[model samples]
Target: MVGFLGLFAHMAVIGVDTLFAVSSLVISNAITRQIKVGIPVWFCFAFGFAFTEWSNVRACWNDGKEGIIAGSAPVFPLLCIKLLLSWMTENKEAFATRTNAGDNTTITTSATSTSSTSQTGDARKAGGDINTNSKTGDTTKTGGEKKKRHLQLVKDNPDLEYVKEKAKEFYRKNGKWPGRPTLQRIAGCRENHARNALRELKGAS
Candidate 1:
């Protein structure tokens, strides 16, 4: 506990935002190792910031000296990485299991359908062909509509990719993602475009 308190004091010397940024990268890296998928670094930073701030506030209440000793500054952020990593690993495994089960079901159904079709030959060929064509046409129409909408979005935000790369670089340097206003200044894009770029970066795969 004394070692942890010393660590927190050192973190305090480094400043809260900077420490949080470093913590975010650490948390993101740890989670990626466990789950094979990384979370947004900004998310980890935000979580650490909130936790540290709350801990500081609570400890400082009633003129308490333990505010700095409460281990919230940087220690909790480091400790929580393990917790978050475990949580992510469990959730990811569960999702993978469910996805694999779904894929197996789909394959089984497809195989059964193929075998039945082979046996029936021409008996249901006309109906099956019609249904297949209808489904194919509907799928094609939906895909085209989606493509058109995506194209319009891209047209509206020509600087999106550029802003996204800049935002990533900012995160790498500062340990936090820039807000829309900062993004605008850095990317030299319009306010609305900056906002859209930030959204795209946050939702990026």
Candidate 2:
């Protein structure tokens, strides 16, 4: 070791070797980064060109698909066009269904609003206007039920028994219990409120 180090030529050679190794490592790192970026680019170009050539063959030679004949169109263009067309075709029905569902939701909201409005108008049932067969057509017999069934009903027909008496008077005057219109004018209870109370009484009996 001492004899080799003592030689001036040997010392210069060692320094040169160390410097070359470091330069080589730096170059290799730079080349590695370039290769990483270039590989994907090269692959894309190669695949695109190869597929284009293959498409040309299919267009000329007549690839054996069930519907297509040879030389109908350029193969590459046909593939691109069909790819987009098929995607639209696949989603068409789903889009239609979504549109219909939105319409249905709007219709349901409209119906709900209509029902609520009609309920307000229904608050005027005369006692005789009730139905025997319909459970909802029953009347509020006692004063408590007429007042307690619903807050809205209590507000409408504050005097439940007065309405009852009016219906009885109607029977004497007209020979029949007052029907829906008469009861509505007398008691001012909505159809639903009167009907629910009557039903409750009948069920309890």
Candidate 3:
């Protein structure tokens, strides 16, 4: 009876650890944009877990003496790997594409608008009509430039269109589009692709 209880305890610990390890790998891979790397990592983790559990069971069969001893040794290492995987996954960027240009564009536009507004006081002091005309021209130019940028982003990422189409089809069939994580599973494309595609679609409509 004591041996049987120990066996059950060993199995429970191994089962929980395996669950955490597998889930960690899945989430980590999804977040890190390392889906390709993640596949092999998952397999390795699976094999490792299986091996550990087999060792524990084997030790248990011989005698209950080894059950806790064999199982405890691997638990810490598996947990540490799981923790590292979580940290790396969280810190890693989802998309590999450089978003610096997009960020710079926003900063530049903001600076330009602030400067223009500062200059507006001088223009208005000189004449109300002149200030109004200048502001209108600036607004028109800014609007045109933003439109061009958005169009370029869409043109460069044609895959975004396919994602949108697929999302719509999924929604029609399933009655709802999958969440970001599930969508990420469909293809290696990051969340940015989905977000950008949605933005473009809304703008077009």
**Of the candidates shown, which would achieve the greatest lDDT relative to the real structure?**
1
Q: What TM-score does model 2 achieve against the real structure?
A: 0.23
Clash pairs, candidate 1, are none
Q: Higher TM-score: candidate 2 or 3?
A: 3
Off by over 4 Å in 3: 1-46, 49-97, 127-205
Instruction: Compute each candidate's TM-score over C-alphas.
Output: 0.33, 0.23, 0.26
Clashes of each: 0, 14, 0
lDDT score for residue 150 of model 2: 53
**Candidate 1 at residue 68, lDDT?**
49
Error of 2 at 107 (Å): 0.9
Cα deviation of 57 in candidate 3 (Å)?
17
| TM-score (C-alpha) between model 1 and the true structure | 0.33
Top TM-score hit: 1
Q: Write the per-residue lDDT of candidate 1 for residues 5-46, one digit (tens) a residue.
A: 777866763575576768666766767776343466556566
lDDT agreement with native, every candidate: 0.72, 0.54, 0.65
**Candidate 2 local lDDT, 21-84, one digit each (tens):** 4443443443434423345444543454454444445545644653243333433453454355
